[model samples]
Every structure is written in C-alpha cells, then in structure tokens.
Target: MTLYTFFGCLLTAYGPILSIFFLFIAKNAQHVLLTVASIAIQELFRWLYFLLMQRAEPGLNMVTKYPRSPFNRIIFAFVAGYGYALTTSLVSYVPILVESLGPGILMVPSFPAASTFFDAAVTTSFFSLLHMAWMVIAFDGFAAKKWVGSLKIGWVLASHLGASYSTLLNTSTIPFGCIYAMVIQIVFLLISVAIIVASLAKKR
Candidate 1:
C-alpha cells in the first residue's frame, strides 16, 4: 500500500506540479515536527503584517496624490509571501535540491521510490504557493470585513496545518507523504486563486 502511494507521488512530483518546483524551489515541506512550529511562526508574521497594514491604512492618505490602488494589498501580500518562501528554501530545502541535477538517484533503504532529492523538491514546491494563498485569503477576509475568527481565517489555518502535517506521512511511508502534502497544498491554491479572481472582478 505504502509502496504504491510512494510511486504515485513520485510520478506526481515529476509530472503535475513540476512547474511549481521550477517556479518556487528553483526560484520551498516536511522538516520534522518543526513543520508545525514553522507554520505557526510564519503565520504569526503574516498576521502581524495584516494588523500593521490595517492600522496604517488610515494614515496612508498622507501619501495619496492619486487613487489608492486595491492591488497594493495584493502586491504587498505576494512580496511578503515570496520572501518568506524564498528564505525558507535557501536555508533548508535548497541543500537537498542541489543534487537534483546529478545522474545519481539516491533512494531510501528498502524504498526505491523515495528519491530524497526529488521528494524534498516536491515538498518544497508547495511552500511559496501556500504562503501566497494563505495571505491572499486572509487579507481578502480582512478587506471583506470578516473577523479573524471567521471562516476565512479558519480555512487558512486549517489548510496550513493540514499541509504541514501531511508531510509527516513520509516519515512512515516515504514519498507518499510528500505527495499527500502537495495535494493538500494544491487544494488550498485553487481556493485562494478562485477568491482572488472573484475579488479582481468585484467593484470597489
């Protein structure tokens, strides 16, 4: 069962979301139980940024000579997310990814499907997208007059937690866990992208 799952994820990492790795990991999952700690700390900074942006909006009028663009929020969100994702990638995942280009294909003991370099790459691919997704959803919620305790924030945290722990599956099942991790991350991405598209069409 676990073996099939690992192969399924190996194909997925090399196939469906490979572009994501090129964009994010080449341009950022499971780091032990610390995945939990990392997600919490990362979201803490995002929430703090949201609060600061909220308070600064009133005084932002001082610099307004032209209309304040709604896209400004998105720009800031993406920038913050990109930086957060990049920083983590550089310090953690990039080390493993360095060997991705080599001819040698390293596998786990008794697990041929668990390619360490590529599995790490697959898991890393989801971080940048997830960061942007969570921020976009949370930021939009704030703009929509939604409370921090509302469904929007709830979804962000729930998805974040899900994606984080999904990698834990790898500890026991090897590559299957990484596959589970990406699937969860991709689900959150679709939801966030839909919300963003809707917001873009909405009248200010």
Candidate 2:
C-alpha cells in the first residue's frame, strides 16, 4: 500500500514524464489519431487484463465509490497504484543524470540513470497496471452499488486523453517515420507487456 500511494503521488507530480516518453515516439508522426488510439487501447487493456487475471473473490461485479462493505481492499489497491507511480516519478530524474554524468556515472547505483530503458519501461508499465488493477478492485463495489451517483471515472479518462494529445504535440517535432523510431516503439511495447505480465503474476 505504501508503494501504491507513492506511485499516485508520483503520477500527479511528474505526469509529464510519461508525456515526454510518448512524445519521443510520436515525434513527427500522425500522433493525433495514434495518441487517441493508444490511450483507448491502454484503457481497454487495463480492464481486459484485469478480467483475464482476476481471482475468485466474494463480491459484486465491481466496487463503489463509497463502499458499503469493507473498503480496505479497494483502498489498498488505490494506494498501491498511487505509490508505484509516485516512486517512479521520484526516480525518473535519474535518466537525465545518466546522460549528463556520462556513461561512466551510469555504473553507480546511487545514480538511477544506471537503470536501463528496459528497466524504466518495465517499471512504468507495472506502475500503470497496478494503478488500474486497484481501481478495478476498488470500483467493483461502486460498480455493484452504483456509487457513481456523483463521482465519474470519466474524468480520469478525459485527463489521460488530454495529456496524451498534449504530449503528442510536444513529440511532433521529432522525426517519427524512421527505423529507430519503429524500434523504439516495438521495445516500448514489449517492455510494457512485460510490466503487465509481472503485475498479473502478483495477483496470483
């Protein structure tokens, strides 16, 4: 739970970190449609992955905003996701350091840039999956109780979508139609998938 809360804090604080990465890929491409599609896919996959891996539990279809039953489990999920995001954001600055301090500095554990792009991809994906997993876990009750009488998760969707587009704009300056760009996208997807797999394993 501590980690989850930390991630939530991180996401809120350095949300642009994600944008920056995505922008790099989106560089000079038709990111407008791709951005929308990517986010849509991300959201869909979050739920689908959860369903495929969900464990047998005593509960309704989903959670409510304000739970009538014990909400500890849901709280834990949210906190866990938030914590992962927060921690990642805190450490995200290390990559810049790695580039600045030169390759020699990357050898030091104290400098987070020592971590590779694969490491970052895995971490970010894990954080996002956990965040969504918790949401599903928490919202199962709201889903059961129609707790969305006032609160709407749509806002989250909107925020993510907006951020994706904004980041796409930032990325548009770079040349996206290139071998390196394609390789990067492929690697990113692979790392992200690995993260999702890792998170799902945790459920077991």
Candidate 3:
C-alpha cells in the first residue's frame, strides 16, 4: 500500500508534465486522448508496482500467498485504492490549493478546472477502488496458477477511460455526468466483488 502511494505521488507530480510534452509534440492531440493516456500510465504503474513488490518480497506476491477469503481481498483492495487516491490528491491538488491561496507557481497547462475538483476527486476515488478490485481478481487468478485469463488489460483500460471521460465531460458542460459516472463505477465495483467471491468459492 505504501508503495502504491509512492507511485501515485510520482504520477501526480509528473503526469501533467508528460501531458504537456505530448501536447507540444502532437500539435493536434485531443484532450480526451491525453486523458486516456494518463489513465493508461497509471495502470502501467500499477503493473510495475506489483512486479516490484513481488521481486522485493516474494512472500508479498499475492499470486503465491493468496488471501483465503474474498472479504479479505476486498478489504485489501479498498485500502490500497484509498491510499492511492489520498496520495494522488495530496500531491496533485495540494499544490493547486496552495497556488489558489497566493500566486500560482506550477505552470502545467490543462489543469483540471477548480469548479470540478470535488467531482473529479470523487470520481477518481471510486474509479481507483474499482481498479484495485480488478487487480485483486487478476492476482487471484494468477495465484490459482491460471495466468492465461488473469490479466484483462483491455477491460481495465476501457473502464478507466470511461471514468476519466465522464469526469472530463462533467467538468466541461455536462451536468450530473459525474453522478452517472459514479453509478457506473459502483456497478463495476459490485460486479468485481461478486466475481472475487465466486472465484474464492471455486478455490475452496
């Protein structure tokens, strides 16, 4: 979880800069594309995070030392997701908060609108939770020595892109889009939990 937090901070700190670089290079890059890229980068970081964790402490590998209960997996996923959300917000928004207090220092273009910060944070948090839930499912499959179907990168990417796009739309002019997005995310989370439970039952 601590490692996840650290990686979240790194993303929060550097993500905007990378986006700006893309903007300058692509000349006609759409904001939506950049948003998708950002989410994809986060997912990649998640993969790297688990890889490092598995390497640094083999016992920490969920694939080998799987949690015995579905509830435990849910709890672990929630905690990890919450940590990522909190650290990501702290590193990304606190600077903006400080800037709002006085003169702005960080000059990253295309920052999220101040009006949508609350909505974006809420959406991001819930989406992060869903992402972590999927991770748990993926890891559980691996722990069962079934790597073929463990990773669903496309599903993960699509869900994140959907969430981010929804948030962005809400930020623009679409009213209540964030609420709809949250509902979709909640449904996804429930489905993931149900899948995890089923997987645990089968294993037992």
Off by over 4 Å in 1: 1-41, 57-66, 98-105, 108-111, 146-149, 174-177
Tens-digit per-residue lDDT, 53-126, candidate 3: 34533332343234344344333333343344444545655553433334332221233333333444455456
Model 1 residue 131 distance off true place after TM-score fit, in angstroms = 0.7
**Deviation of model 2 at 6, angstroms:** 20
Give RMSD to native, each candidate.
Answer: 8.8, 16.9, 13.6
How far out, in Å, is residue 47 in model 3?
Answer: 3.2
Candidate 2 structure lDDT:
0.38
Per-candidate clash tally: 1, 25, 0
> What TM-score against the true fold does each predicted structure earn?
0.65, 0.32, 0.50
Model 1, span 28-113: residue lDDT tens: 22112212233334666767767766676555434533337766566445545555564565566645554555556666432457
Q: How close to the true structure is residue 147 of candidate 1, measured as C-alpha lDDT?
A: 64
Best by lDDT: 1
lDDT of 2 by residue, 59-171 (tens): 32244333444543443334333433444444663453234333332222222332333234334444454343434443342343354411324533443444334323222
Candidate 3 lDDT (Cα, whole model)? 0.48
Error of 3 at 170 (Å): 1.1
Q: Which pairs clash (backbone N, Cα, C closer than 3 Å) in model 3? A: none
Residue 54 displacement (Å), model 3: 4.0
